[model samples]
Target chain A: MSPADRFARLPDLLAADSDLQRRGRWVTVDCRVDVGDQPFFLALENGALAAFERGTRLMRSSAFTVGATDEAWTQHWQPVPAPGWHDLFALTKRGVASMEGDFRPLLQNLQFFKDLLALPRRLPERI
Target chain B: MAPVLDPMIGRYLRLQIDGVDHRVYFEEAGRGIPLVCLHTAGADGRQYRHLLADPAVTSRFRVLAFDMPWHGKSTPPDGWEKSEYRLTTASYTAAIRAFCKAMELDKPVVMGCSIGGRIVLNLAIAHAAEFRALIALEAADFQQPWYDTAWLHRPDVHGGEACAALVSGLIAPQSPPVSRHETLWMYMQGGPGVFKGDLYFYRVDGDLREKVKSIDTKVCPLYLLTGEYDFSCTSEDTLRTAAQIPGVEVQIMKHVGHFPMSEHPAKFREYILPILEKIS
Candidate 1:
């Protein structure tokens, strides 16, 4: 899938997943290069950023290369001059906060709901 | 040219404690009394890198530095005991204590910047026998009654962005992208965890002011170092917080922000090394 398409569908996937429903319907895009720096992965998922990082339902930040590549996803990432380290850091922080705000309910009741889900439901006694 | 001193490189250890390998990067130089150095909330031990590099500074004492659990080389436990238990000052302090026991050193003089300082306070008080002296820089108490009225209500603070900048500053101005990423990830994990922990720490109604004052770690010649432009806490508030703890030696550095060690290492040593000497 193309980068834009994949990133766009991220929200839908999160919204559809029952497990991530608690993270609320929000998508965040994070990009990172692999260990070898050969391939980049862009994580587009519908849910709060914090949930991806700290909670379950693993999320990967989107990654791309600096030069030409045959991979379909790789073509989607065009050359964009990188910001200063400080500016990029600021952007990430803002984006994370924005994700958190978008998924406020999840951020708010995250602990309570997660704990509740972990507990076995107490079904009403059979009449 | 950043100060032309040798980069202090020593055994970066990983001690298995509480089911996780707690990585401690420590360099012991000029032994007299041991100084256990802890970095601020978002940064790792290397924040004190220059200060440790200075012969004038390292000449005074042996330094035990560790990237706190979930920070630097240390990663969070493979399996958490509980879901919401990953970010807690108490748990981090336990890891530090475990590291100390593993290394088999007396409490020595414990100095921490920002959250590091707060952890030291937590450790010293909870494990009173562990600490000989205490130094805390720009400790935050967002849950405090007064700060809630001021800090929370202030719209201009930009807490999140400010925090991000601080993170960038710590790692930036660098080489070897692999090392940089590793460092960044360590901080990313540590920052969110510590920030979350602080939110929990300050949720109480009564001020921690009294609890901070009550810590019995023998005053050990308390020292407070902060930047003039510290966004974490106002200069007035920093002084006030220092005053709450009886008989603390306070020094305010000019033309600096929240991360004094990063911005002004020489000034930091000027204020810090003397105390290390006295303790030694």
Candidate 2:
């Protein structure tokens, strides 16, 4: 399957996973996750991933943007990524990823977002 | 009876720290040289549960783990609500000294993790003669804060859950499911704003690069063990800090991360048992 097609499945996959739903119970925000240069905008409402947009919309704004290189994302989803690649913050701390925009919703629902971004790991292989 | 009682004993003592009365909670077991264990930031003495329970360690050393004021079962000093909780270098070392004096621990070996790891260097610097040895885990001389700590205690966030989640990534995936979750539970139970308060010391007040050379390893030996997966204070950080102190021993543990004792007690035991033997 194409990478975009795989990302398109994020909403349904996230909604179906009860554990992810519980973790995101308090989160409601639209955030953009960039895998390398590919942008995937995700809308999280209350506890569910409301929408998944594969491409950037004109004049579209997000609550936050969390991104890493294709290399970093690939490493992070390796069932067990190496020491510096295991976590989003880990990637950020190591200078391989970036998180910017309004800090409130992003930091408040950090775990939810972390789990959300790593959802691809549950897939059979790296997307 | 199927019910199993732990070999460790728990008790509380009222001690004066910085002229404030603090009811500190502590647990201990075994007998020999006094081995005082210090927990990580925002965590209590309970992190050392496995160490305190192990017969191999206890038989040769009196393992004592104490919860600092404002952590674990320990109570904050009177009028704590009016002021912010920021741990400074002086206050941290002073508390350890006072605890040691009150307990009459004669030159005890002090072993600590995370924030506990940072302070042991100061303990060695300011008062090396007061200890038999110092074991530092997941430690470095200095670590810049990687994220805004304010997120840890914001009104909009569930402080406990946020704190636990933020730290969850620091534990290695190689750790057992039970040990990993148990380690995070400590953070989940931390008091509001306490984790941020601890970072005040970890990130701001505890920069030890300039002062570490003052640590005299001759008077009290210094041992550092960092897990391979702890990006916060990566193994490189431990090695760099160890290089600063002549005769300081350093080892990088494989298949473990931060919160070694809590996240993988059995694995942590493999690394620490050898050190305990060397100290013996």
Best by lDDT: 2
lDDT of 1 by residue, B41-104 (tens): 5457776766677677676666777776555555545663354433366566766777777877
- RMSD, every candidate, angstroms: 16.9, 1.6
**How big is the RMSD of model 1?**
16.9
TM-score of each: 0.54, 0.96
Clashing pairs in 1: A26-A47, A30-A61, A30-A62, A31-A62, A41-A62, A41-A63, A42-A62, A42-A63, A43-A61, A43-A62
Model 1: how far residue A81 lies from native, Å: 30
User: For all the predictions, what are the DockQ values?
Assistant: 0.03, 0.75
Distance from true location, Cα of B71 in model 2, Å? 0.6
lDDT of 2: 0.88
**Superposition TM-score, candidate 2 onto the true structure:** 0.96
Residue pairs with backbone atoms closer than 3 Å in model 2 (clashes): none
Error of 1 at B237 (Å): 2.7
lDDT tens digits by residue: candidate 2, B175-264: 999999888899989999998999899998899997998888889999999999898899888998988899899999998999999999
B-chain TM-scores per prediction = 0.72, 0.98
Query: How many angstroms is residue B47 displaced in model 2 relative to the true structure, after the best TM-score fit?
Result: 0.7
